[model samples]
Target: MRFMWLPIVESVRMYLQSLPEIAETYEVDLIGNLPKGGGSSIEIDWEAERGAAETVNTTGAVAVHLLIKHRTDDTDIWRAFREQYRIQNLILQEIRRLHDYILTNLKIAVKISATGVEPLGDMVRPYYGNELILVFEWKGAIRDGRYES
Candidate 1:
């Protein structure tokens, strides 16, 4: 039996890369582990996988984290908040587009299960940053698989 996690991750990366907003706006990285550092960047990381074998098919869900970060040196708190908010909206718009694209092209089920905002304070003297965490649950299937003892 085989899990389709890696393929789905790759597909998502390719799809995001194809978007001009995401591609041109931030540095995109497919990290094997949780991301670090503070900057304007988009990091894709695989969080976890859950599955079960039922008769002839295997069903599972893979959790992918899309981390969007925006950092500013401006001391104005309101300006930093507004910038992060704007960036969050832009990323969410693209994600909504991706949801439709996945349904039509990949023939897989995808949903945004959770979202969060992380404030990483002061990496280099008043470098205020906000990180948006988007958790995408991707449902996938594996056919013609047999469990061997």
Candidate 2:
């Protein structure tokens, strides 16, 4: 609820604002643990198929349940981010900039892993709760940015 210095909070806010850039750089509609964002949005679903585990291609919505977080303790967050074309490229630039800042200045590394679930057979049926959890790891490095033991 308080701060010893202003730079601490300001630095935190800067890091928080970099979420959108990171997501777009990785070609994902949304990403990161956004501090206090996500206001309003919409979700778009399409049909597509073809993965390493599939024999015959299937057709279904190529989207997942857009994550919406509660703004406050009482109000529920109904935001569903729909993929947009025009802004993605611009966002990527910012992502890369943030990445550089993290790598060169912050001396930190980030990794993300994502998984998905599909129908056992090809039926093109609507499935429930098919998604994956992306884990992000930030390994802090030394001042020289070398691997820290």
Best by lDDT: 1
How high is each candidate's TM-score?
Answer: 0.64, 0.27
Give the alpha carbon lDDT tens digit for every residue of 1-149 in model 1. 34656766776677667777666766666763434554566667776666634344444666766655555667777886776677667666767676776555555556665467776554343444555665555444533332212
Q: What is the lDDT of candidate 1?
A: 0.60
Clashing pairs in 1: none
**lDDT (C-alpha) at residue 63 in model 1:** 70
Candidate 2 residue lDDT tens string, 34-117:
332343221112222212233232111122222222112222222111222223223333444544553454444434232332
lDDT of 1 at 53: 47
Candidate 2 positional error at 142, Å:
1.9
RMSD of each predicted structure? 5.4, 15.9
